[model samples]
Target: MACIQVVIWLFVVQCSAVCFANYVLKEEPEYKHTLLKRILMEENFESLESKINNLTQRVEALEKENALLKHAPVAFLAELTKSVTSQNQIILFDSVKLNLGNAYFNVHGNFIAPVSGLYQFSVTACAATNHYIVLELIVNARVVGKVLTGDTGYNECSSNSFLVQLSTGDDVYVQHKTAGDYLLANPAAGFPTFSGVLLNVI
Candidate 1:
């Protein structure tokens, strides 16, 4: 009976030991799996943050581009008008006539260099007879190119386009052959007008 009791006690101890070992092994593997999952989640979060930053930068850039496009046309027209004279003067047009010789007319402005690129320039004029209007691209007080429009009737208008390479300190202007009130008479309200010249950088 004593030997049988001892044998039973040993069997119980062995079973308990085996069960504990199995539990330890299973729990360790679960802990390791949990650690690995955490690491992967951290990596994914970092990747997501990077992508968000890039998207934010792109959005900001697009906003700036949109603003520039919105203001471009107005800036272009203002530049053209400002280039005509150094002082601030009101532009007047009545019945297709531009009162360019009004006592307020002043044609003096400093030319600053524009961006270095191919620039397109255009001039439109209105006259009663086929008279000549000379458009000039002036750089540093020198005429780079002189464009002449042939005689146009008082009720006629003409446009000329030119490709010019402009640097800083470039200027442009239109001179009429006749001094008498040169007006552009056309259906357009500002017909005998100098819409002023435009320079499109390409």
Candidate 2:
């Protein structure tokens, strides 16, 4: 009887040890799997967030480029209506052949810059027979270019062009550098004209 009781007790002890070992093994793997899954989910979320931020920045840059393109084309051409003779006088190119942006005013004979940018300007002048004319291209009260036309044996024309940087609201026009008898109006010698175009935005 004593031997049988001891055998029963030993069997019970072995079964309890095996059950405890199986439970620990199963629970440890489930915990590790859960931890790994959570870490992977967090990494994926961070990667998606980074990609979204990069796309948003690119979209903003494209919007700015589109706005610049919308306001890019700016140009004008004007011709003198009458002769210029006095010193320090504003040469009025009253006949506007083309005015894309309305920046040139025929009344005041000046171009007010609508936007800040680099600009290219041109001026054509003519002199009557036996007379001479000196013209200066002025920008905001500063002389940017000059031209002189004289009787080189007959009526003739002279032209000048320059590139300059202008700010919004800056004034540009042609003025007589010196007093003269008269400026000729002939089609053979090119018409007295003033023209400008925006080259680039700064």
lDDT of 2: 0.84
Score every model by TM-score: 0.35, 0.65
lDDT of each residue in 1-202, candidate 2, tens digit only: 9999999999999999889767866878986677678877878788878999999999987776665577857899998867766676888888888998899999999999998888999998899778988788999999988888888588788888899999989999988855566776654333889999988665
Candidate 2 Cα misplacement greater than 4 A, ranges: 1-67, 187-190
Against the true structure, candidate 2 reaches a TM-score of: 0.65
Whole-model Cα lDDT of every candidate shown, in order:
0.45, 0.84
| Candidate 1: residue 38 lDDT (0-100) | 83
Q: Which residue ranges in model 1 land beyond 4 Å of their true spot?
A: 1-112, 130-132, 146-154, 177-188, 192-202
The alpha-carbon deviation from the true structure for residue 8 of candidate 2, after best TM-score superposition, in angstroms, is: 38
Determine which window of 10 residues in candidate 2 has minimal summed lDDT: 181-190
